[model samples]
Target chain A: MDKKWYWGIIFFTVAVNVIMLQLTTRAYLGREFEMVLPYSIVGVVMAGIAFFTFLQWKKVEYKEDEK
Target chain B: MSECPKSRHANKSKNDMVNLVDNVEQKEDLKFNRRAFLKSAVGASMALGLSTVPFSVRAMMGLTDDEEDRVEIIDLDQLPVGESHKFYYPTEKDQALLVHTVDGDLVAYNSECTHLMCPVFYQKEENKLLCPCHKGSYDVNSGQPIAGPPQRELPLIEIEVVNGKVYAVGRQFRHG
Candidate 1:
């Protein structure tokens, strides 16, 4: 797969994580405990996806494409 | 011939050529590579995600707090309509206000203004809460910021009227 594809997923995760952190903090401040858990869970999942996508990209990036 | 200044790998070439036809270690590609950018993005996502864990932990802890404070503030009749009674609820440190709005609705909130923690007082005439220090204001009924520098609403104190007496049962740090 192209490296840019990995970047796209990673960027999306970064964006989602930003939103999740904001919502989690807001729910925490609001004392709405029920909402915080879901937001945090989503954030963690996105982060994991980003990490795996990065590892895949790493495998591709280190190998010189030119033969 | 002298090595080309552009290529750090120029000396590595078997021939002492001024400009190497090809170099394996391309400095420009190394400096601005997709791998480096993707690594940074992954790191940022990880950091952003992990940062919320603390908040989640704290929120879980906050949920366990009991809702049975049920401290009596004053007699319902003692607080006349369109008047306010100052009280300490749940704890003496949490200064709160129980307002009998002109519309005959009972509402309560922590008197500390959301902006800069200034004390907010009821303005019966204006029918709103006012922070004198910065002129911050909140809607009397909902505790939402209405004007001035305040951006967040005051913490609301949940109250219950039990047989001619008012009791504060719980506090919500944020609400509409």
Candidate 2:
């Protein structure tokens, strides 16, 4: 709801994306090819959400600055 | 310091907002530290889990314990020279071909073809191991691929005959 909370959300989503990407890479190294696609997709989705939240946080910051 | 009650209330709200922002920052820092620890812990555990799995699979794939290393496949009196006994050795996952050659030498080898992991059987009439999967043929004596798509030799299992019993002692694979 607040600008601070949006920043937290961005941090969490970025973390999720990073962890998912790492898991996907590990799965590849382990020869678990079946898992690679699903984890990569999840990581990508999380990254997208994180970027969207970052934009929203920026808009809120701009509004605060204008006030 | 004769501030109005309204101004005092506004000041209190501002202090609360600052406290909230400070709390969020503190929680973010804690989360970052916790995530770092979790990342390392997860990485270590994942590495440990992946590293130990293959050994367990190999252990399950008929690499039996030492006390049970000697597999009593068939009786020497029952298996005559030039005859072959198809059985499982060390573990059920491993198929073995225990053959008594015409020269009276007892030899055994893995029954899986090296080409595509197809099951190989002793063709006693032909005196060779034949893989019906691709018409692959292997030397019964040396377990070498004689005619087939296989480029590797079949793994050999060491055999021992003591008294009237035939036992498979150990196994050796061609490593290059």
Candidate 3:
């Protein structure tokens, strides 16, 4: 896979994290547990995914030079 | 020494397969764990939403938004003489009490303590409404505070018995 593909995934995960964070705050303020729980879980999961994708991007850039 | 092309091709393919498996097992970290996350998120949200709903919202949810004028209190046969039932009347925030003083005689009143808004429950043994907060007591028959800090009577709840069912139709508060 191209190094650029991993970068794109990283950006996408970051976007997801931001959106979920906003949703979580709204739900908390509204005092709607129906929205808060799901949004918090999704936000944390997206953050985890983003961290892992960043690691993948680093691995892609520093691959061994094939002779 | 000359290597056979077929054997060389086979060796390369096996190495590629091994590398592919290793990459999938160790380095493919961006895989979205959709199934597990979805299961946990949905289960948690539903459990919390159902359990933690505020009392007011839960009451509103029980009755449809359009129909707030009338609320069913209880069944007539369920209330025997000398027993009282606590329920909501007029609105979800308003509490009311229903009692069958005697055979074929049903009475209802707002259960809030007129002095401080504390909930009042019927004491069947004493046959009076007792507010545990301040020991305020209201007469079960007249709803007038007979003892303690209460200064007024509990609002009367007009009850309607339709086809063996009891409904709180309206409320009457003390004038002046």
Q: lDDT score of model 1?
A: 0.85
Q: Which candidate leads the pack in DockQ?
A: 1
The candidate, 1 or 3, that scores higher on TM-score is 1
Q: Scoring only chain A, what TM-score does candidate 2 earn?
A: 0.87
Q: What is the lDDT, from 0 to 100, of the residue A30 in candidate 1?
A: 71
lDDT of 1 by residue, B30-123 (tens): 5556556677889999999989998888888878987547899999999999999999877878789999999999999989887788889999
lDDT, candidates in the order shown: 0.85, 0.67, 0.65
Winner of 1 and 2 under DockQ: 1
Comparing 1 and 3 by lDDT, which wins?
A: 1
CA lDDT for candidate 2: 0.67
Indicate which candidate wins on TM-score.
Answer: 1
Error of 2 at A38 (Å): 33
User: Candidate 1 - CAPRI tier?
Assistant: medium
CA shift at B13, candidate 2, in angstroms? 55
Error of 2 at B45 (Å): 28
